[model samples]
Target: MGERIASWFAAGHRPLPWRAPDFPAWGVLVSEFMLQQTPVARVIPRLEEWLARWPTPADLAAVPPGEAVRAWDRLGYPRRALNLHAASVAITERHGGIVPSDVDELLALPGVGPYTARAVAAFAYGSRVPVVDVNVRRVLARAVRGVGEPGPARTNEEHALTEALLPADPARARLTNAGTMELGQTVCTARAPRCDSCPIADACAWRAAGYPAYTGPAAPRQKPYAGSDREVRGRILRELRANELPVPRDRIAQLWTDADQLERALRGLVADGLVEIGDGGFRLPMH
Candidate 1:
């Protein structure tokens, strides 16, 4: 099954920039940060622009962190930009501007968590580590566990299951890692999986079990954006991004009608270190 999935991905995976043969590890790190919660289509252009402007960790580390936030440009979860910037600074200062391949070293960097650490080690350095994203988890649940959906994340178990499926050879293990993710992203999608087109369909336990409906605790759903504090935050950000100088407090207040919601968003942004209040007014942090 692993072999089949690797073969399937090798034959037809999308030509994303980070997947290119000559792509730098720095590019992979940037892509992983930008791709969080953002769709691939939106990430491609932003990734390209980010790499073009700051080709190395040292380059990004040279600039103000606010530049990174400004470059984030509606990616949502603006804090990831700060994390990426801080990580770049750490890499430049501690690792001689090189993205670390060791999972421990990667995890120590700002914004690099378990999944991200493994992903960079596997995908960027071909380190033979299991890289399970949401997509890969879905693939595992159906193909091996005979379930329609994975239950709430149990990190250790996910790694163990993915590791058990990996090939013995390092190169083959890398292929399996990439292929499983591709299979999940393209074929074994969360909604409306294409069982007929899946390369591992013959071996899929879920197919053999007649695709039972998932009865596990449901994945948490995102709240609606309309009239939410997030909407207020975005409006405030847009206003700040549009202006070179700090937006006046009154002008910032005019963007959202709900004063309480706007205040909450502003306070949240400041608390998150994404925004700052000063004598001039409210603005993106620039130190």
Candidate 2:
């Protein structure tokens, strides 16, 4: 499976900037953050601009966290900006401006979870660790377990499966990891899998089994964006990001009529350190 996937990836994988051999580890880390819950097309331009603006972890660390939030723009989840800023600061202060190669050290950084840690280790450092994400999980579910979809969340079993599939050679294992993810993302998609084009289609268990429908628990649905606290929070942040000075309370109130929702959103932003309340007005956090 790894061999076939690697071959397919070599021929067809998208030429993303971070996939380049000489791309900095910092760039890989940033790409991972931006890719979360965001499409590749949406992330690409923003990622390119972001790397050009702050080329190194230390360069981003030198600026206030607010600048990171402002630069984050309309990425949906603004807290990721804060997480990236904090991670950059950690990398600068503790790792001497270098992204850590060790998975444990990477895990210790803010917002660096198991998947991200393993990804950085394998992709950036050529570690022989399994780099499992949702895409990989889905591919494994269908191709190996003969299921239509993966489990609702990643499991220890999934990790073990991915680990077992990794090639013994570290560099080869890195290629396999990335190849598997790329295959899942581009071909073995959830809605419309291009099974005929898949490199491992002939050997796919799910295809042989007649593509069984998933009977497992459904993944949780995302809440609607309109009229939600999230919407109000985004609006508030947009106003703040657009202004150099603090936005007055009344001005913020005008963005949304539901006072309770707006207040809750403001409080949540403040608690999340994405906003600062000062002098009877609100603004993006200064630090």
Candidate 3:
């Protein structure tokens, strides 16, 4: 299955910039962070904009945290920008502006958890760590375990399962990571999987199990954006991001209807490091 999948990737891999030879670790790090939750199509434009503005970790670290937050644009998780800024600063200070190749050092970065650390180590430095995100977990579950879907992947078993399939060759490991992620995104999708076109379809145990219906507990319901504190927080952050200086509370108040909710959201941003409280109102952090 691994060889077949690798063959598929060798035949038809997309020409993304980060996959290029001499691709900087900073570029790979940015792509990994941006690709979190956000789709690839959207990440490409935002990533281009980001690299255009701040080409390296040192370049971004030279700026203020607030600027990073604003530059995050409409990406839903604004805190990620703040965390990225912090990570950049750490990289610049501790690693001499280089993204660390060691998994332990990479994991020590502020925003980098297990998945991001492994991804950066594998893709940027050609290491052999398993890059098992939700997509990879789902694909592995179906292909290896014959499960219709894996439960939430924040588990030890999921990590071990994915790691066990990694090729001993580093290059093959890198290709395997990309292939699994690509397969999950394109073919072994969450809904309406393209089993016929899947490279490892013939070897997939789930398909062999007659593709039985998932009888596990249903996924939890996501809260609506409307009337939620998250909505108010986004509105406040958007207003602050648009302005270069501190925004008055009254100005932010105009963006949201509920006063208390707006205040709570604003405070939440401050706590999340996306905003700072000062003399009159709120502002982005100084570099």
Candidate 4:
């Protein structure tokens, strides 16, 4: 399984900046952070700009949190900006300004979860660990388990399957990790899987099982972005990001008619520490 996927990865896979030969660990860490719930195309340009501006953990840590929020722009989840900034500060202070390659140490950093920690270890440090993203889970489900979708992550079960497939050689294992994720994103897609293009299609369990419909317990679908608190939050963040000066209460209210929702968004941002409530009204965190 690892060999086939590794070969498929080497034959294709887009030339992302983080995938470059000897790309810095810091760059890999940032790429993983920015890639969370965000598309690769949108993340690429922003990732480049971010790395160029603050090439290291110390460089990013030196800037105010507000600057991080401002640079985050319309990334949807602005809290990630605050979390990334906090993580940089942690990396700088605790690890002497280096992104830790050890999974446990990586997980210690703010905003670093199990997946992100494992990713940094594998991709940055060449650790022989399973890097299972949503894509990998889907691929595993259909190709090996004969299921259309992986359904709400059963971490231990999924991790065991991926770990079982890992190559003994760390380098080969790393290649498999990248390959499986690529296959999931490009070939074994959630909506329209391209079975013909998949290298493992011939042996795919789901195909052999006649492509049964997914009827088991599934992950809940995401709520629509429009008119939700998320949309309101984005609007508020957009208003704040556009202005060098702090936006006043009434000025922001003008952007959205739902006064209650507007207040809720502002309060949410402040509570999340992404926004600061001050005499100047609401603004991205300055301290």
Candidate 5:
């Protein structure tokens, strides 16, 4: 299965910039952060722009963290920008501007977690580690475990299973990790999987079992954006990002009528360090 997946990936995987052999580790780290909870198509251009603007951790750390938020520009979850900024700072200060190859050190970065740390180690450093994401988890559940879907979150068993399935060679392990994710994303999807096109379809346990219904805990549904506090927050940030100067409180208030929700969103943004309120009214944080 791993060999088949790797062969399919070699023939069909998209030519993503971060996947390039010459792509810097810092670029791969940035791509990982941007790819979280965001679509690949949306992240490509933004990731390119971000890398062009700040080619290294030191370049990014030199600027105000808020600049990262502004550069994030409609990525939806703007907090990721702040997290990336903090991680860049940590990388610059502690790791001497190099993204750590060790999973433990990568996990210590601000906003990085088990999955991300492992991804960086495997993809960026070519470590013989399992880099499990939602897609990889789904693929493993169906292909190996005969389950219709993986659990809501990653488990230790999933990690061990992925590691066990990996080839002994580090380079092959990297390809397998990427290939599993690619297969899951393009063929063995969450809904309406293209099993016929799957390289491992003949061996897929779920397919052989007639695609049984998933009985496990389902992934949580996302809340609607319309009339939500998130929308109001985006509007406020958009207004701020467009302006070089701080926006007037009244200007921000005009974006949303619900005073309580708007205030709550503002406070949340402030607490998240995405926004600042002072004599200059509301603006993206500086310094």
Candidate 6:
């Protein structure tokens, strides 16, 4: 498995900015957070802008959470921005503004779950750890285990399976992680995979399994944004994010016609710390 991954790494590795030699831990952390559920192309510009503004964990920690959400743009998941902001503050206050190297320490930070913690530790600190993201999981599922894509989300079994495949050597471990991720992202894509060019195609179990189609129940699609509360919430946040002063409830009322659902969405934003109520109105964080 290690030899196969090494060959893939030699032949096809994407030139992402975060993988550069000069990339700092802060940049790596931001890239990971931004890449969550967001495509790489979309994340590139936003990541560059974000890193330019906040080059360090302390720089991000000093800003307000609302600013983080505003900078997040149309990333889909706004909570990740808030969680990242909180994690930045935690890193500043707890780890002296440096992204911690310890897996346990990284996990303790806000929004730094198992995969993220391991990724930061391995990628940023050059530690030996398996970074089992969905892409890596899917690639491993097809190439190694001979299964279809892994289930909707991470499970203990998936983590263990990936861990077992990681190279014992620390540097090789990093290469393995990067190689598997690249394979999944480029060759073993979710639909219409490019198996002919895949380096590991010779050993891939899925191909040996006659490339059986994913006949099982597909994952449920998310609700559309056309008329959902999520759309309303996005509008409310956009207005508040652009305004300095407290936006009157009337101004927010103008954004949507569904009074009841809009109200619920507004309250949800407030509850989520993406907005605050003061002076008889709502406002983005002043910072």
Give the per-residue lDDT of model 4 (tens digit) for 1-287.
Answer: 77899988988789988777599999999999999889999999899899999999999999999999999878768888899999999999999998998999998999998899999999999999988899999999999899999989888888888988888999889889999999999989999999989899888999999999999898878999999999999988888888877888889879789899888888888899988887768888888
Worst 10 residues of 5 by lDDT: 3-12
Q: Evaluate residue 276 in candidate 5 and report its C-alpha lDDT on the 0 to 100 scale.
A: 90
Better of 2 and 6 by TM-score: 2
Show how many residue pairs clash in every candidate, following the order shown. Answer: 0, 0, 0, 0, 0, 0
TM-scores, one per candidate: 0.97, 0.97, 0.96, 0.98, 0.97, 0.94
Question: Tell me, what's the RMSD of every candidate?
Answer: 1.0, 1.0, 1.4, 0.9, 1.1, 1.7
Question: Compared with the true structure, what per-residue lDDT tens digits does model 6 show for residues 218-262?
Answer: 556788888998899989988987887889999999999999999
Which residue runs of candidate 1 sit more than 4 Å off their true CA positions?
Answer: none
Reference-based TM-score, model 2: 0.97
Model 4 has an lDDT value of 0.90
lDDT preference between candidates 2 and 3, better one: 2
Question: What lDDT does model 5 reach?
Answer: 0.89
What does candidate 1's lDDT look like per residue over 23-135, in tens digits?
A: 89999999999877899999999999999999999999999887898899899888899999999999999999999999999999999989889988888898988888899
Please, what are the lDDT tens digits per residue for candidate 5 over residues 1-287? 78777777878688888788788899889999989889999999999999999999999999998799999999889999999999999999999999999999999999898888998898888999988998999999999999998977767988988888788888877888999999889889988899878899999999999988989888787899999889989999999999878898988889888999999999989998999986768889896
How much lDDT does each candidate structure score? 0.88, 0.90, 0.86, 0.90, 0.89, 0.84
Give the runs in model 3 whose Cα sits over 4 Å from its true position. 218-221
